[model samples]
Target: MNKETNYQKALHCYIQASLNILNHFRSSVKEIHHIGSTSIEHMDLPGEVDVLLLVKDEGDLSKLADHVRGVGYDEVEDFSTGYIEEVVLRHRYDGYDVNFIMMHHKSKRKDEILYCRNRLQGSEKYLERFRQLKAAYQNEHINGDEYQVKKSDLFSSVMNMQGDADVV
Candidate 1:
């Protein structure tokens, strides 16, 4: 199939996955956003979706963990930004790998996450830079962690340039 066909398929799968999660946690979540490369238009990605789930209260973290686990999402990790907590869960939905990131509504990390996503969405220059990085990572065949670190570094640099503190 052609690249556009592949991208269309991936985008469809991503949206379906997002809807499934949104429906599952309709009452528990404050907001849900499509983040990461899959959310960016024309960005080439394997069928994976990054979802950001904001909860109304901090106490909802454990409840969400249980809720997601009951529905087949495995707890990927528990991470934080010193003052705020974030939980990551992963599951396969409709042939798409979905990374569900849950955080409290008050977490400052949310701003950073949205900012990075919006930056990529708003600027072809930033998007092209990210694409180049992804290409080089694929060419080198590095592990996923290494690729994440490189992406984080690139994002951190961008955030710093805008006078924001480094997030990753």
Candidate 2:
């Protein structure tokens, strides 16, 4: 019998998803980055791939969202924040829940997100610790806005571990 795992996906699946988005967004997208737990080697994930897409500051997000949804990708509207908005898209590809973040090239938050990912990949010890924190959060039954807030907290903790960490 073939069983599907609820959480965790092969790293390459996430990579391909990023590539696909990159291709679709081509000239408009400056770059696409792989992030989240899945981006960290050998780490258990919730089958969700977090990808960051860098676009021009004036990029039309609604159009992009419509385009991605037209192509059969799921849109995650729950990820936007006030002051600085980030468009997040999700899709289940090859059993992986892939998420794409549409961000502007000059956004400070974009740099912070990239920094957090780098920090996570830099230390095996810290990565394992973060895995545990994520595992514990799974049992907390958090949802929507709270989940996003908690995720920010997780990133902050991870960055702080590296000492003198910046925003996350």
Candidate 3:
């Protein structure tokens, strides 16, 4: 499928997943954000919808994890260096992979997450830079650690420039 087609499919999957999450979590989640490659328009398609689920507090993390598993989401064992204690859950929705990143409402990485998404959504320069990085190291199985660090640095550099190092 073409980029537009892939984006459309990914978006459809995000909407479906978002609705299901809302129906299931309801008041437990403070906010739900559509993030990552699929959320950015004109960016290279990853075909996976990355959802940020901000719960009201740290206590909700375990609850959400249990809820996700009960609802059929498998916990993805991510080896990437994590900036915070966040829960990563994955499930296939309409053939597209939907990743749910559950974190506390006051997590330090919250701004970074929103900033990255907003930057990519609004600025073509940053988006192209990100696209180039992803194009070079999209195949993670071959260069997992390197790819993760570089991707993290890409965001960290952007955050650092704006004096948002607390989250990096």
Candidate 4:
């Protein structure tokens, strides 16, 4: 399939997954967001959809995961950073990946949802810098070695901007 078709398929999977979660666990989840590269338009395939599942409490995280799995998503792995539980799921039909991150109401880590949204709303200079870096990296304007260096720098700059926000 073409890149556009693949992206649409992935997006459909994301919508389905979000609806499924909301239908089953609406009370526990405070917010469900579609984040990461796929959330940004005109970007190449990032191969997965990153979801941020914010909840009022962390005690019901396992229940949430079970509900997601019950809806035909297979759990691939789980990660915990003392503040949140990150549950990775892969859809059986399309193999599209989704991350169900369970975050407590109180956490110091930068909020992924706010970070992504803020970055997108950042100044034109910041956006232009990112665009130039992305284009150069994608088009092989810079060699492989230079691409890695430049990519890291670009990412750090974006992260720094996002980090300035209050996470709550």
Deviating ranges (above 4 Å) for candidate 4 = 1-9, 44-46, 78-85, 92-95, 110-113, 120-154, 162-168
Please write out the lDDT profile of model 3 over residues 30-51, one tens digit for every residue. Answer: 9888888778768746657888
Name the best candidate (by TM-score): 3
lDDT of 3: 0.77
Candidate models: Cα lDDT each: 0.73, 0.70, 0.77, 0.62
CA deviation > 4 Å runs, candidate 1: 1-7, 78-84, 162-168
lDDT of 4 at 42: 44
The TM-score between candidate 1 and the true structure equals: 0.80
The number of clashing residue pairs in each candidate reads 0, 0, 0, 0
Measure candidate 4: CA RMSD: 5.7
lDDT of candidate 1 vs native?
A: 0.73
**Measured by TM-score, how close is model 2 to the native structure?**
0.74
Ranking the candidates on TM-score from highest down gives 3, 1, 2, 4
Better of 3 and 4 by TM-score: 3
